[model samples]
Each structure stands twice: as C-alpha cells, then as structure tokens.
Target: MIEAIIHGVILAFGLILPLGVQNVFVFNQGAIQPTFLRAVPVVITAAVCDTLLILLAVLGVSLFILTFAWLKTVLFGIGFFFLVYMGWVIWRSEPLKVNEAEATSFSPKKQILFAASVSLFNPHAILDTIGVIGTNSLGYSGEEKWVFTLATIIVSWIWFMGLALAGRSLGKLDSGGGLMKRINRFSALVIWGVAVYMLTKI
Candidate 1:
C-alpha cells in the first residue's frame, strides 16, 4: 500500500508537471481574482474534473469511450477552437488593478465552464489521464488499487490549490501591473501554442 501510494503520487505529479492549458487558466484565475477564497471555485472545478477523469480511467470506462475515433476528433476540434478563443481573451485582457472600479472578474458559472472545457476537452489531458493513469492502474488490484487512486486524487487536489496560491503570491508581488501584463501575454502565447499543437495532432 505504501508503495502504491508513493507510485501514485510520483506518477500523478509527473503527469501534471507540464504547463498545460488547465494549469495556466487556474493560475491566471488565482492571480486575477480579488481573493484566494474567490478563486476556490476554479480550483475545485478543475480538481473535480480531473477526479472524474481519473475515476473513469481507473474503472475502465474510458477504454470504451476511446474506441470511437469520431469522439477523439470531435474533442480535439472543440478543444482547438476553445484554446484559441481563450488565448485571445487572455491576450486582450487588461491588467487587473487592485483599485480599478471595473476590474474584470469571472463569475462562478464561467469559472466552472472554463475549467471543464480545459480539463475535459483537451485531447492531451484525456489521453494522459486515461492512457497513462489507467494503464498504470492495471498493475494494482484490490486494496492497492484503492490506495493508489486515493493518492492520485489527493495529489491532484493539492497541486491545483498550490498552483492557485502560488499565482496569488505572484499577483501580490506584481502590484504595479507591469509584471502582471507580461505574465498574461505569456500565458496567452502558451495557450495558443497548445492549440496549434493540438491542430497538428488532429
């Protein structure tokens, strides 16, 4: 069980280390939100999406879904356009000011929808969770499998919250708005780059 836990943590962390669209959006929300508590919805939504994917993968439901080629193509098409749109929005977003009366804010509904889009629509995320995590789970069974699943889920939740907090800390440091603007631009580029990469894959 200890080995399973360790394996789960290491594997999950490794898979999540990449600066994917989901992580970038979560970090952006954390940085732009007025308060950490206000950012909780985004964090929770992302974590829940990942948890569902992981659960589906581990239980083998993802295998059935993956059998259909059209589904993958559809997901990729949706994801590509969504990423492009999100990147454009981020690129054009004005630097949020602490005292600005019209500072932009994402409502809970928008946050949930965006979080789900990034988590569920991205072919890379789906494949990673289902392909990597599911294949790995095949090595364990019974108590070990449960332990492994729990560990991976816990890691995901912790990682998302940690990312939000880290972004919040950076946001605090960039009170002047200059650094924040640059960060926003860079985030947009990264997102668009992911979209282009997805296009190539499809």
Candidate 2:
C-alpha cells in the first residue's frame, strides 16, 4: 500500500508539475476572482474528472491500449500535437479578466462545465492519466494497487484544491495582474516541456 501511494504521488506530480491549461486557469482564476468561494466549485469539478480517470486506470482498461504497439505510437503523436496546440492557446491568452461581478456571482455549473471541457477533453491530460499513469500501474497488486490508485485521485484533489486555496492569498497581492501573467507564462513552459518529454520518451 505504501509503495502504491508513493507511485501514485509520483504519477500525480508527473502530471501536476506541468505548466498546463489547468494550472494556468486555476492561477488566473485565483488571482482575479473571489478565490475562497470560487475556487471550490472549480477545483471540485476538476477533481471529479480526475477521479474518473484514476478509476478507469485502476480498472485496467487503459492499460489494454498500451499493449497495441501501433496504437501507442499513434497516441503519442496525437498527444504531442494536442499539447502544442494548447500551448499556443495559453501563450496567446489575454490576462484574466477581473470582473468583480463575475467573481462575486460565479456560476458553479458554468465553472464545472468549463473545467470539464479543459481537463477531461484535453488529449494531453487524458494521455497523461490514461496512457502514462495507466501503463505504470501494472507493476502492483492487491492493496498496493488500490492505494496507488487512491493516491493518484487524492493528488488531483489535493493539488488543485491547494492551488485554488493558495490563489486566495493573491487577494492580498498588490500586483495581481503581474503575478498571474507570470504564472501563466510559467505554466506554458511546463506544458511545453512535458509535451516534448512525452513525445520523445514514448
């Protein structure tokens, strides 16, 4: 169980450490919004989607695709192009809008759906969770496997929620705009790095 949890954290960080759209969105949201209340709905949405992927990985369906050599090749290419496209978008994104009204009356459903669109549908996120994490899960058994899977899910919940909470601290930041732009730029670099790594390694 401990081994699984450790692996899970490693996998979780592998994905979480990247400067992807999710991180950029969360940072931007935190910087310009009423983060305490807004972050919950957003993080909850992302965490639920992440949980579903972890569950799928645990069930072993994701591992099945890894067995097919050609499919794996195709998936790597697909993931690579997808990351490049997303990186371009993030690179071009305008600084987050600071609408006080939007922050105060944030719509939970809209945020959830928006987050789902980014996290669940993004091919890079899917490949990381399903392809990378799923492929790695095969080296465990019984309690260890379950612990590892649970740890992966918990990582998603903990990291995103933690990011959301940390964004609340930006409320005290005088230069929120400058700070957020830096976060977005940092996230772009991380995303591009991961994408390159994924493309080359697989």
Which is the leading candidate under TM-score? Answer: 1
User: What digit string (tens of lDDT, one per residue) describes model 1 on residues 119-174?
Assistant: 99887788998888998999999999989999999999999999999988888887
RMSD of every prediction: 1.4, 4.6
lDDT, model 2: 0.69
lDDT (10s digit) by residue, model 2, range 1-202? 6767888998898888776667765655555464467667788888888888778876886767656777767766765665666566556654444444353323567556556656765556667788777777888877888888888888888888777767767744634466666665676676677568667756
Which whole-number lDDT from 0 to 100 does residue 32 have in model 1? 81
lDDT score, candidate 1 = 0.87
Which residue runs of candidate 1 sit more than 4 Å off their true CA positions? Answer: none
lDDT of 1 at 166: 92
lDDT of each: 0.87, 0.69
Clashing pairs in 2: none
